[model samples]
Target: MNLFDLGWDDFASKSFHPFCSGDLVPARVALGHKHACELLSAHGELLAECTGRLLHETASHADLPAVGDWVAVRLRPDEPRAGPASRRRADIHAVLPRKTKFSRRAAGDDGGEQLLAANVDTVFLVTALDANYNLRRIERYLAVAWESGAQPVVVLNKSDLHPDPAAIRAAVESVAIGAPVVALSAAHDESVAALAPWLRPASTIALLGSSGVGKSTLVNRLLGEPRQPTGAVSDAVGKGRHTTTRRELLVTPSGALVIDTPGLRELQFWDVANDSLDSTFADIAALAARCRFGDCAHRSEPGCAVQAALEDGSLDADRWQSYQKLQREQAYAARKADPRLAREHGTAWRKIHRAQRMQQRLKSGE
Candidate 1:
């Protein structure tokens, strides 16, 4: 396979040059498992594991290989293999710097970043139009997409189930800001063509959303085969069963690369900056510029444009609230990631607690 078809460029070539003189070969990670990975190299598809040195030298799990990541691997061609059970394999030594990455806070209380997909050019934020339609969720996805340094296109799947797909697209457009919103039923082959603009050859796109949002179905449609499993939504909760358990990168017949991620049960903020948040909530940011106070909180602050818009029904109440909620969550995540911010937050809370205690003492005539 040509490296260009895998989204490789001169930049990647230069980055891999230092390793090329050695026994290492360039490859792109296709499927990432618990301890092993499937890579697509110039020699063809092969299974690979991280070298002990690589693992020991890595800072965290985020440094490990992820689907769509380009890496240097040492092929074990001389090793005798039996059949399909023992195919060609290699050891990943190094991961090239990613041009773009989609990530979220790792699940659990560890407060670590989790890399979802790397070197992606576009992110398809999929959402089912059934009972699972949610604008707030879309906003959250958009914020992360912007943070990933990739163009985000909102894909509203299951359009056939919705009475008015256009109306649904319009609703998504309101929160999507400048991002394109595509409404199509992935169940039909023709409808999937709507995504062709973003599915260009030699570029990579990732399917991300809550489980049962038809991400796998969309991949199957694009592949023109049932390569990915599809499951029915439960009649009780309208949620689809989790079929994709891991992230896998697949090549479409048109030569475009697509990564399908397991349905995200929880997507928390990690490393989301103010610029990305402003980009996602451009409407709110624009309004904030006109506020009388430079540091306007936009809550009950007087002459706050955001508050004025909300009162006059100019801004969607839900969108504004979603922005505020995301802002707080992002701030909290930042504080957790930075010790100074955490210390300042702790000190402020301590002051507030002390003030409350003083008020209580005064009431008690102490």
Candidate 2:
């Protein structure tokens, strides 16, 4: 397959222009190994590792080439990254510009960013109908997916297990604003058809969710075979067994490119603008806009539209709480990423509270 078949285009050509040379060739990272990566090039698949320049020059792990990333590589017959060269060993020099990338805070106390998927066109947030399903989790996925510059699709898998799948879909739809919601049982062959619209030829879609959400089963269903291992959900916990251990890119028979990832137990945001949060909870944002006080906290503030909606039957109280929780979480991440932001965060909230008090006094004619 040529570069075009691998989703290469003019933008990629331009992004890789500076690195174009006789020795370098364009390749896509099909799989990322701990010390090496499997790359797909015109000459075929080759095992590659980062050059000394890339290893020392990159600022963080996010800078390295990852699965689904197009990169400039040198297929040297003699110069492998480590020891003697293999059949078609390669050295990844640099990664091309990523049109879209899904990222999250690195695991543990380390304040770092982890790139989940790069150069993806769409992100399928899969969740099972059993004990793994949660509206809050879906909202969190939507927030990161929105910030990733990719179209978000909520896949409600294991529909066969739920008696009221339609009702659950309706409930999920209420929170997954501006994103398509698909309900299907990945075990059934016919269910693959529901995911066909996003599986267009050459387009890239990444499947992401927590363990036991049927991600591997969904991948196998799309492949028309059991290439990926599948496991049954534990009856005691109603959760799925984790089968896929790593992230890899696969091409379906229909020609669509897919990146399947291991289940994420915790998903925290990296440094991101509030636009993503606003997009995820647009209903709350729209209500907050109509509040009498611009600085109104959704608590007992007068004419607080968000509070009003919570009091009436207009908005679900859980969703409102979810929005606030995400807001706080993202804020904390921002502070950790930038110490200046951390210093200003307290002052910023104090200013808002002072303004709120003034607004309240004016509204009360004091």
TM-score of each: 0.91, 0.87
Q: How many backbone collisions does model 1 have?
A: 0
Error of 1 at 74 (Å): 1.2
For candidate 1, write residues 58-117 as lDDT tens digits.
987888998989999999865776765654789999999988888788878866878999
Q: Residue 20, candidate 1: how far off, in angstroms?
A: 3.1
Which tens-of-lDDT digit does each residue in 97-165 have in candidate 2?
A: 898898889898875888888899989999999976899999999999999999999999999999999
Cα lDDT computed for each candidate against the true fold: 0.87, 0.85
Top-TM-score candidate index: 1
Best by lDDT: 1
